[model samples]
Target: MGRPCALREKEVERVFSTPTIQQINSDYAEFFNLVGNNTGVDLSENGFRDITTVVDFLYIQVSYRIYYPPLPDWTTEGNVKCNNNPIIPCKDKTVYEIMKEMNDLRFYVMYNSTELHKLDGGSVLTDIGKKFGEYVAGNRSVTYNIYSAHDSTVSAVLTALQISDAKQPEYTATVMVELHKSAGDAQGHEVKVFYKPITDNSSIEEKNLPGCPSPCKLEDFLQYVKRFEISDWDKECGNNVPTTPAPPSTDSLGLTHQEKITIIACSTVVVVFCLILLIMFVRKRSSRSMAPYLSLGTGA
Candidate 1:
């Protein structure tokens, strides 16, 4: 597997919590809406008041499919066929079609929510591409840069790389990045990048970096990857902004009760500080004047 490339925490993972059923429903409802906006799935079906209702219905439908395990392309989303279901009359709502909506909903949730780049609507790609460049440049000395992360991490990285063609990654699915250097001819040396989806098969020829021919040259790949590297990542990220608070509100001349109290307290401190400073300034001036007279031998 390629090194786990993580720059920002997945926003979905942060927002998706399992604290309570209400919280889960609320989160899922928002997620469904976001997905619906993209997929144009009519989530308001069958007496559904809100997106939460659709989510609840989906859960129930999924549960029913799991329990009965419907028959002959009639039961589940992936296997179900609308026309030739021998067991039940569900041409209108054959399994996969309904499931595909849910699937599409889920896909759009991950697809839209994730950040693209810290530089420009992107973040993970910036880091991942830089890391790939580093690896290709023979800079990293570590054995394994591990990514003990969620499915969102995998999805986010893929989306950032502009590579996510398939559905979300399965559990423990590894995306291997193979950077190979060839010594076919004495005239020139070449390097290519290959990405393999999580699979048991040994063959990785199908997952070639698109547009670039297989066994692509090193210089060419470097030039291609350089686009993802931002000129100033820190500036682009806005990381150096100080945490200094906004100045107190000055909307009204007459202060409210709380504001009155705050202003009074502040005025007291300001007066005290100014008085102390004035006293010091006067004493310093007096001392300077006194010094000249004292130098005249205490007025003879």
Candidate 2:
């Protein structure tokens, strides 16, 4: 299943919860009504009343028969069929638009603020910049640096660069940062950003960071992205709880084997002395009772 809405902001969490199936039906009643009219199936009155069922339905709409071995002849959004009829006949555009909204909302929740952008994408961009700087300085040999990341990373980087189209990143979405230099150019090396969406026919698309040229100069790109760079991630993310010092090791308690033996011997001696005193007290009381009995016998 796709990730649930990323309600990261306190206000967003406070204001929203998972929408019930009934709520979804109510909110998107018009879209559902159109689907029902076109397909002769009232989703609201059917098993779609449960949210899990609706989510499964949406999943089926987007990903149909793409996973199993011996994949279908063709698997695309166009192949989404209801009763063996193409979904396009049932207002597929509306369905897709709703899906897009779901993705846009999720992106907004995780990458809305500048700080969030830094926490999610700033460090990554910083590392790329530093590595590229190393390569330019002739200190690095590796040419390709690959990072496998989640959709949130893609969304965050796009948002940080102010180039996000506000669409939900599809599965296997990728963002690439490349360094380039023109032959003996006065401007020296430059940086370029490219993104590839998850669509079957999707190709890498060049993206320009806001206020920067298409092929942004390395120096200017570094300067622009510096605002998002973070030196201390823990401090920046407010994860600054003082660490609890580890407990002292038991072996470091400074007790020698001989000292331990001496202490145990002293404790045993004290216990034995107290036992002897208790025995004497008990014998004295017994003797006193016996003497009184002997005196009564003599009197008798």
Candidate 3:
């Protein structure tokens, strides 16, 4: 994070040398850069320390407004703190406008970012597909399936299905998938999915699961959902190199088989030559010592 321009460079390196802190610093810096470039604002003063302060404050404001409408203006609210200053004026923008802008930014980051959507959303999609598969296969006896997930979770699922139009789901938005059976239909079972809005209860936003008919057959629904199912989530998550252990090397410190063979042959030949020389020396020494005894005996 380049010492944050506030702390001593050496101290920052010493205190935040750990990988977790480094990652946090890295993410904070990226966010500051992205926001600063996009909004032309100075976030350097509170880059890592208070980057999310305003957003958090907005969430609180929005929360309070749920029960009590007409809360204080978010753009000119005293709740936001940056550089320890409150009530910063952001010309002529209101709470609703700021909220919408934030949502759009979030949608762009979580859904429109293709690689990120795939990497982050892939596992969630796979899990849901497996859950549905169990129900279709008659293994699960449950009458209903309910998924409680975050906005990003729902958007990621949609992104993985290649049906995301990259818009923020409104507050308390939900996507519901229902499975049913009927006697009149040729297919044994059928499926219908709806996007229910929080703003209006009467809206029934029925959307097709790409390449499938509305209220598709249970078999077709199963097959269509399986398209997003991954065999292994970890394999497709990213370019993580597999950590398989390699087999033991046989060559012994990089000596080839031919080199070992030549060395062994040379050693064997040297040993055999030494044995022959030793035998000849023993026979000659015995003969030399016996010559003196033979001469003494012959002197008689």
Candidate 4:
């Protein structure tokens, strides 16, 4: 006798007809249609159905594989898959790995091109629609308002901006945001963004200078939809004008020659002091042992 099939035709049909499954399928179809229409990509209903099924399966498989423990309880002698493998398991996985996995899954499906995979036009319609909406009204423009943060944040921001690929140390994301407005009404609109990292005490001092304003607060960014304001041609807004300061002989923090010399001298003194103490301790111990041996020889 052959083994029975896991799902019969009627049973499969019944599962698909369930309310939860039906709602998910409807949502998936709508998402596919939206992306395809917005990006001007063509996709068929069958293709959409197939892609949806594949994505759903991948999500389930990955989630289960990554989170399911070999042993559910100590009482059970044999190793077995988790009975209720939740999408997110708090005890089994680290928060960072979970976040990374989620991000990878999202980016992969969201950015996959239909042409490359011979997917129907509807495959990337949802993502394209999201991108379009974001480009038009979202805060895609970089903001330089963070003045204090971890180095990882700085590295991430730099990566996003196509700056240096160097990994920053912790707490280096402190940066200032500068916004530049468009030149004239005829030119439509444009904004220039600038970010400066604040790493040391000197950077903090520069931030507290007389004229330079602090980075806009998070609340300010949230409240103000537009970070840049239109420059009035009549009044001097100083948007286009370059305000150059006198060139310093040293670095921007104005560290004078004397200050540099003093710092170097202090460092040398501290090092020499430690060396002298170490030598004195060693010599004193050596001299005591030699004197005792000399006395013993004379007595003998």
**CA-lDDT, candidates in order:** 0.48, 0.62, 0.55, 0.37
Candidate maximizing TM-score: 2
Per-residue CA lDDT of candidate 4, range 189-260, in tens? 332224344444454322321122334232233223221222332132222345678764775778877788
The root-mean-square deviation over C-alpha atoms between each candidate and the true structure, in angstroms, is: 15.3, 10.6, 13.0, 26.3
Collision count of model 1: 8
lDDT of 4 at 174: 43
Q: Where is model 2 poorest over a 10-residue stretch in terms of lDDT? A: 79-88
Q: What global local distance difference test value does model 1 have?
A: 0.48
Error of 4 at 253 (Å): 77
Stretches of model 1 off by over 4 angstroms after superposition: 1-97, 104-125, 128-140, 185-205, 230-300
Query: What residue pairs are clashing in model 2?
Result: none
Candidate 1 Cα deviation (angstroms), residue 31: 15
Cα-based lDDT at residue 41, candidate 2:
59
lDDT of 4: 0.37
Q: In model 2, state the lDDT of residue 252.
A: 60
| Regions of model 4 farther than 4 Å from truth | 1-149, 169-172, 199-300
Candidate 3: how many backbone clashes? 0
Cα-based TM-score, every candidate: 0.42, 0.56, 0.49, 0.19
Residue-wise lDDT of candidate 1 within 81-132, one digit each (tens)?
3344232223466443444444433443444433432222244444445566
